[model samples]
Target: MQDTLSNKALLKATVIAVFIAGLALVSFILPAEYNIDPTGIGAKLGLTALANPKAAVVSGAETKATIDVPKSVQAADIIEVIIPAGRGLEFKFAMEKFKKMEYQWQTDGAAIFFDLHGEPEGDTTGYYESYAIATLADMQGSFTTPFAGVHGWYWKNKSAQAVVITLTVSGEYSVIGLKK
Candidate 1:
């Protein structure tokens, strides 16, 4: 009879331990490491940002600007910009409907968080669409505008040191300008 009671107690303890471990995995480990927050606790605790590769750590005001290009002009522009540590900058070009552009950008051996996005022309609601969010040292791609709008990249230098970015563009964009 004593043996039966001891066995029951052992089984109960084992089940409880397993349940607790599962709970920990679901609530903390998965969310903190992989951004899988089924319970939403990770976002409340700000752990999801850590898991996001494109989340920028900005420490100051960001600047933005637009450059106008003649519609009939054809050229290639290479722009270089420097971002201080913990600061961010935005560079964009005005594009017309169905316009296409090829672009390549690289950082000075430092990984930076970036958002590739577009805003429709005369959008007063401050609405924008995000095409990609990435943490990378370099990127190369071609974009075809779905509508008349401004398409560009927002890059943030999250490291402890300043970083220089070089952007090369070819194709149908009218104007290319930087914001701060």
Candidate 2:
């Protein structure tokens, strides 16, 4: 009799399994991966921070420019930063529509996941334009601002050790620096 379950018992077990899976998805998977915490249980458990920092940035408060650049084109300036292990941050610039800039950046032989994007000024909808997204050790190019706003790279270091990044740029832009 113990070798096989009755049809009713089998059906009940299946239903219970499905219910537990759904609960886990809502309480753990959704919040940890997508930053979706409709039930708030995940936040209570400190799972929301497991989500990619990009999600936080998207939902974060608007940031203002830090340093205003002069009107004339200046020599390329170098900026070096250290990304803490398993952490992420952003370095942005403010520019007017049609302004152009040349940039090059490389890490210390470690590949990093990055998103180069722009957010228009006065936007409250958490909308931004993504110019590039990739995992690479270096990037170099020029870009013309599509709108008067902030542009920057969101660099995520998935490595266990801190990674150093060196960036050089010459453009008509104001340095927004590290974003909070």
Candidate 3:
């Protein structure tokens, strides 16, 4: 009788384990994509797209991107975009410290390390930030406008040859007081 009871217990455990495994397999097959703003925020009003200038690849050339701040851009708002590269590029920012907006790669891509300093204010206020130290990989979200202002995207060629990167911007944000 003891042996019979043990067999019944084992059978029940195996059945339960199989049911859980089937549930996990179904979850894996479901959709996993989530839509997010360029700033990394969950959702916001406005459209999003890659915000970069025209790109060209020239022989024996080093690819670079200069973040251009338009005169019309307000001080309190931030613009977001992406810079595409062949393999990958090293990102350097002009700010003493900076933050990376949230993002997702359409394909398998390299990781990025964001170095930021100073204190974060409002939502993203903090002293230092990094994509490397922190858990974030590729940045693909929104950014908070700084008090003094911030701009520029510097990248290095990850491949043996030259590469051209078009500034890629995503998401839409209101100008605070723009006419719309």
Candidate 4:
């Protein structure tokens, strides 16, 4: 009889321990980085003010324009690309596409971060959205047009210093929304 009681108690303890461990895994052990807000500050992630690329320039011999974005940025966010006409690198050198602009998507800010390295590896072309989702050191092709509008922004980095990109819009931009 004593042996039976002992066995039952052991089983119960084992079950309890297993349950607690499972809870911990879900709450703390899992990767909650992609999680986002359902509804808080901004309205539905919708169309925002268009970015005037002609209003600014990503210049300097080694001046790279870096833009950081929160991971919450969904596919509907507006990512305006503005390359204002200035005394920046001429179309020849400026036309080169950068092999590494280094970019990332964040949930805390749903921000897109990157830098505009010296000469580009190629040209960045077409319309893109915000959170146009890309990872660090993982990018392809180049941008041709001076101005572009995407759902989100992303880039690759090949430089040494981790550049922090800031979007200096000519107008107010919209906030990004993450999946609920």
Candidate 5:
């Protein structure tokens, strides 16, 4: 009788341990390592950024084809753009493979949804990649092009008021233009 009781307790303990481990893996490891957040907790905690270092590389390659920019842009472009409420804009520059660009942009204390991405030229398939997706008042970073194409930002103002964006870029790009 005692042996039977011991076997039941051991089986129960083993099952409980496995269940707890599975929960941890699904909730934490899956999001932080693979960006697979079925539970949505990873996105809320910002753990999604930790997955897939290649996301930036894929974005640069994909963004190279999406927008059209001038083939002869200056080495430095400073532009201030105002986006009215509920408006959006796309600004991009023509870049070559391995070219590097430093950029910074800021809003007037109002947050906006921004996509930093790239689309390759001559890709009519309408495919692009995203390096970053942010909802913030400002962003600053530098990118080394993974492939030749157009690279830039698409921003939308969902706020109740107009937002001013001041953008500064210096790099190996040929031209920068706003997509109309």
Candidate 6:
């Protein structure tokens, strides 16, 4: 009968849809989104770069970026900050265009979300350029200022315990401490 044929066709369509979804998950979604390609097809097809797209970024592990130590670091300042549990904080520096800074920061064994960014001086549009954003415990690198502004980091602690952040930096800029 026509009714039976329609039912059978619907079942076949459902099965085909499910199969395609599963295959896409294994082939594209897992590799492109999470960088976990169990079948190695993602790597072969160059889908792994879709994971973070940020250079020297770490999601859940420590990835250290080595930067050349500049002579300006002779006046480097090491600041220790304690971020309360389940809170966030911002620390920054005032620098001119084309200036450079070498820095490193680390948390007390807990991973946290961090956004390294810069906001141009006297901008009221809430415009900020993020250099990197990642969830990790430690990172180190040298950064050259792109434009005159306040450049620094905003770290958010998501754990129940307080996190102590020790940051050391040397640069051609003034420190605009935590409450700036």
Q: lDDT per residue, candidate 6, 1-180, as tens digits?
A: 453558889999999999999999999999899989998998778687567332221222222222222222234566666667887877777888999988899988998899999999899999999999999999999899999988999889899988888787777886665632
Q: Candidate 3: worst 10 consecutive residues by lDDT?
A: 171-180
Lowest-sum lDDT 10-residue window in model 1: 53-62
Instruction: Report every candidate's CA lDDT.
Output: 0.75, 0.79, 0.32, 0.30, 0.73, 0.76
Q: Candidate 6 at residue 48, lDDT?
A: 71
Among all candidates shown, the one with the greatest lDDT: 2
The top-ranked prediction according to TM-score is 2
Runs with alpha carbons beyond 4 Å of true place in candidate 6:
1-74
Clashes of 1: 2
Please identify model 1 stretches exceeding 4 Å from their true place.
1-73
Q: How many backbone clashes does candidate 5 have?
A: 12
TM-score of each: 0.60, 0.61, 0.27, 0.22, 0.58, 0.59
Model 4, TM vs. native: 0.22
Residue 143 displacement in candidate 2 (angstroms): 0.7
**Candidate 1 C-alpha error for residue 128, in Å:** 0.7
What local lDDT score does residue 4 receive in model 3, on the 0 to 100 scale? 52
Residue by residue across 91-177, what tens digits does model 3's lDDT show?
Answer: 322331233332222212434333322223333553333322322234444454343223333233344433432223322221111
lDDT, residue 121, model 4: 27
**What would you estimate as the lDDT of candidate 4?**
0.30
Query: RMSD for each model, in Å, please?
Result: 16.3, 18.0, 13.9, 17.7, 14.9, 14.1
Looking at candidate 2, the ten consecutive residues that score lowest on lDDT are 53-62
Estimate the overall C-alpha local distance difference test score of candidate 3: 0.32
Q: Rank the candidates by TM-score, best first.
A: 2, 1, 6, 5, 3, 4
